[model samples]
Target: MCRQIHPNLAKDSVGLGGRSKETINRKWDELAICLNTHESGATKNGQCWRRVSLCYILLFILLSSLIDNFYNCAESYFSL
Candidate 1:
């Protein structure tokens, strides 16, 4: 996810080239704080949720494929 540029900082040159070092450093500090907060909340329960969801999706795919193969084999056997 991308952060929106602060209005005051947006008009300046990219990379904060035209701004004072203090202002640029302050912006970087703000960005770091935002990232830390976002990650902390996400990590609290996100890991387990992601793992469970991924496993379920993969299991569903595998089961569907197996069912399709079984149906094909049954169809051929019956047609013979």
Candidate 2:
């Protein structure tokens, strides 16, 4: 970000004038290109895939149990 911006500052400070809007825009595009070039592509947590899948499975089990308990209570109320 700084490398892209510094050229414009030098232009204005030395009477050369800041980058033209077009030049600034091109610099911004290049900056984005450079920034994205280094991406590792994986942005998730460090957990292994199997552990993550197991966590989701356990969560589903707990949620199903809650739903079953709720329906059981409703059924008992309707029976009464």
Candidate 3:
């Protein structure tokens, strides 16, 4: 949580030699905490969305290919 990490980060930022490392570590920790706390359902939702979008893209491509094939077939039939 932000509440837990903020105080430590504030303290670390005031220190000199290892401040950069502490800040980076704190940021990574914050990211881990946030992801652990918040992304449980959201991660599933995101994957689901990606799958659905991929399906839609595949369907669109299939439909377009079918339409193109049909158009070519019709053109050849008319020419013959």
Q: What's the true lDDT of residue 38 in model 1?
A: 63
TM-score of every model?
0.45, 0.42, 0.46
For model 3, state the Cα shift of residue 30 in Å: 18
Q: What is the C-alpha lDDT of each candidate?
A: 0.59, 0.55, 0.59
Q: Write the per-residue lDDT of candidate 2 for residues 1-80, one digit (tens) a residue.
A: 52544455224232334646555445545544544466675333322332454578789999999999999999999999
Residue-by-residue lDDT tens digits, candidate 3, 1-80 = 54553443333353556577656465555545554476454433323443554688789999999999999999999998
Residue pairs whose backbone atoms clash in candidate 3:
none
Q: Which whole-number lDDT from 0 to 100 does residue 38 have in model 3?
A: 68
**What stretches of model 3 exceed 4 Å from their correct place?**
1-44
Candidate 2 lands at a TM-score of 0.42
TM value for model 1: 0.45
Off by over 4 Å in 1: 1-44
Ten residues in sequence with the least summed lDDT for candidate 1: 41-50
- Models sorted by lDDT, best on top: 3, 1, 2
C-alpha positional error of residue 24 in candidate 1 after TM-score superposition, expressed in Å: 27
